[model samples]
Target: MHFQWYPGHMTKAKRMMQENIKLIDLVIELVDARIPVSSRNPDIDELGKNKARLILLNKSDLAEEKQNDAWAEYFKEKGFSVVKVNSKRGGGIKSIQGVIQEACKEKIERDRKRGILNRPVRAMVVGIPNVGKSTFINALAGKACAKTGNKPGVTKGKQWIRLNKNVELLDTPGILWPKFEDQTVGLRLAFIGSIKDEILNTEELAMEMITFLTEKYPGVLEEKYSIEISEDSYECLRRIAESRHCLVKGNELDTNKAAILLIDDFRSGKLGRITLEFPEDYE
Candidate 1:
């Protein structure tokens, strides 16, 4: 299914990012570990030029560990200091300070020569909506300093959080590009709940999930649902409905409800640690 979403507030958010970028020493970008490439807004490359760049693959616990390593390497190859983090659970949060220092070592050395000492690095947390920017900030700061929600556009404005003596964070609202030139990227974003569910067809998205699982994961759905896998996505979804007992008034399979359940399972990592995009795919 074709997919695209660009809320008007995102334009304002982008403008705000550009305006505040000059005030920061680094850009700490968060991307969904499952869809690292798709979750990244490439515009940051331009907005953050000459600034230290750190890419946190947040929600890493929900993604495959092997793929997470590859993704970290992928960004590092692109000259970004990368860390795989599960901000919700605090995995890999402690090392962030050291990594941040490493990322800004050059700037720190320059500051020392200029007689500036102990000045914390100013960083802006940015990403597409629902990729866990505020959550990551909270995890790093060890406090609920930034507003957070599971839905898109929750952190409507910016808030500065003093992470420590060494770091300060500027949390910005999530923003998506004005267009999805490649629909596949959009689909991957949708699968990870980066896009709003209100604008999507649940059954269609579930079908897309079924197709991906069958091809790459193979037999995972069958094992999860205790049902025979089928070549047809609809049949697979129907079997999921039957196995989950999603039934309607006449005892017919409620595929729509099953669709929502299946999608939610994937998003919540109940479907196992799955990564939608691979580094090899980009190469």
Candidate 2:
């Protein structure tokens, strides 16, 4: 299936970010731990040039632990202060304050030299849709200062949230680039539900997912659905439908229902800690 999604709001969001970047001392980027590279908006790097960067591997708990560490190292090597966080559970929220301070220490020192003191670091929180930017902000702030939702595009505008005397966060709506140059990037984003499911073909997406699992994570589907693995992804999906009793009219396999179920399982970590991309591959 061809994957492409860039709603009109994203253009507005990108313009807003460009305008606001001057006011911020740091850019706190959130990337899904499952597909870190694909989930990143390349425009952020351009818009945030010369700004200190902190990349939070959001939803790290849903990804493979080993891959999470590798991804953190990869971003760190690229000069980003990286943190692995499960924002929903507040797993790495506590350390963020210190890390933020560390990331912006140079700016803080520059401010001090100019007789500025106790200036709260202004950070812009950014990420592609559904990478959990709002959730991370809420977790760090210890309150629901930003709207949180399971789906993408929940936060439509910018809202500045004061975390403490030392830090403030500008929460922005999730934004995707106008187009993905590589279809693989689009596909990976689609797999992680960054793209809206309404525009997608669930059956084809499920089949794509099945193919990936069969290649990279063999035996997972078999163990989860209690079905023998099939060479064809459609056959595997059919088996899943039969095994899970996803039937529509008169015992006919409801592949759509099964597709949704499979995607949901992957998203919610029921399929286990799976990371679709690896740092080594990028190297």
Candidate 3:
């Protein structure tokens, strides 16, 4: 689910979003719970303006509970209905229906005043690739009696999954591109495996992760790899290499192999529930 963004892809995605956004009354945004801010596309705010907004903190199972609460509050402060969810195991998903109604309350009230009645809230799921968009959709729309739709000669249009009497979701999730202009954003996305590894130096990336963990999530390296934290990130990496037996021929520690191992561990949640950025830290 790694994404490589190009200008052409960006343009096409934007076009599709514009087209689809018109068909929905609510925008359900999914962001990785660990790197909530960095995993977002700023363009969504502009495109989704005037729509009922709900931010679902996806992958909550892999993020610190305190951080997840803080993130929900952060989005709530910005006027979005927020829900912390772990799409992988269906955690917090049952509450989604209630939250969606709350988010679109104003819209429903307005419709009522205009004599509109019983209209279901139309919503769509959107996020950067590999942020578990598909998993969230499947989890929300599990095996049930569902309906399909088709427009004559219109490329077999979208099917709305009726979640209940008051909500219908778009079948396809919108894919948004990450902010590539910022080096830090790119690095964070890379660390989460949202971007291609070929474009990055694994050793350098691992060092950056080591530096972040030691400073912000203090003791993570020590607890997981049994390595003493050092002022030098490279030294910590070497310790991990030794503990993990990431050695080259002749039994010498292979720093490159160790870098890959460290990155994999962090991405796979082996390091622990971690949030790369925090609201206070950004402030």
For lDDT, the strongest prediction is 2
Q: TM-score for every candidate vs. truth? A: 0.91, 0.91, 0.92
| Candidate-wise lDDT, in order | 0.85, 0.86, 0.85
What is candidate 2's local distance difference test score? 0.86
Residue by residue across 71-157, what tens digits does model 3's lDDT show?
Answer: 888888889889999898999999998988888998899999999997899898889888999888888888762754653432455
Query: Against the true structure, candidate 3 has what lDDT?
Result: 0.85
Ranking by TM-score: 3, 1, 2
Tally clashing residue pairs in candidate 3: 0
RMSD of each: 4.8, 5.0, 2.8
Question: Which residue ranges in model 1 land beyond 4 Å of their true spot?
Answer: 144-159, 173-179
Tell me how far the alpha carbon of residue 135 in candidate 2 is from the true structure, in angstroms, after superposition: 1.5
